[model samples]
Target: MKLTETTFQDGTPVDGYGPGFFRIGGQRYEGAVLVLPGQVAAWGGYEDTAPLIAAAGDVDVILVGTGAMMTHLPPAFRSALEQAGIGVEQMASEQACRTYNVLLGEGRRVALALLPA
Candidate 1:
């Protein structure tokens, strides 16, 4: 049998999450957050599309964490990203964090736009 450590070369993985916060790398972020390769910042939820759109060239897809449960993205929100050539995936906050870490470990270009969970 073989085992290997999950290494995130380009960015940090989600360490933990609960209630209304997420701990990444070793830092705790409150409220909504935008997690991009090698960068993490506060996000203004759905209305804040500039940051996400600006990240289009850096990422292929974005995993959107819609609080504690999965929910459909607003039509305009989805459209804006798609128009910018960025794919969007909607899921619960917990799932999004897990998926983001996995993808990051694989060296895929991905980001996270998360609401509180």
Candidate 2:
């Protein structure tokens, strides 16, 4: 079998993640983070909807990382994004990171709102 490198043509892929931080595109970011195509920013968790909302036009879906365990998003928060026509998927941080990288490598319009794992 031959091995091939995965290349993300549209955005930065998640490189690694740990207890309180994530290494994205070779950059370290602590706390929650929001990663959109070609950009990454410090996120303020679920309550911080402005940045996600602002990205509605740039993304088709957002994968939300709920720390180490999977959890449901707040009703209001989910509602707000849905109202903005943004699709939201909630999963554990580790999974979110992996999924985000896969979708990004496909050149899909996707984003990540991740909590530390």
Which candidate has the highest TM-score of all?
Answer: 2
Candidate 2 residue lDDT tens string, 1-117: 999999888898999999999999999999999998768999888889998999899999999999999998999999999999999999999999999999998889999999997
Q: What tens digits encode model 1's per-residue C-alpha lDDT throughout 1-117?
A: 899999989887899999989998899999999998768999998999999999999999999999999999999999999999999999999999999999999999999999997
Write down the TM-score of every candidate.
0.96, 0.97
Q: What's the CA error at residue 58 for candidate 1, in Å?
A: 0.5
Best by lDDT: 1
Instruction: Give the lDDT of residue 100 in candidate 1.
Output: 94
Question: What's the C-alpha lDDT at position 58 in model 1?
Answer: 95
Q: Rate the local accuracy (lDDT) of all candidates.
A: 0.94, 0.93
Model 1 segments more than 4 A misplaced: none
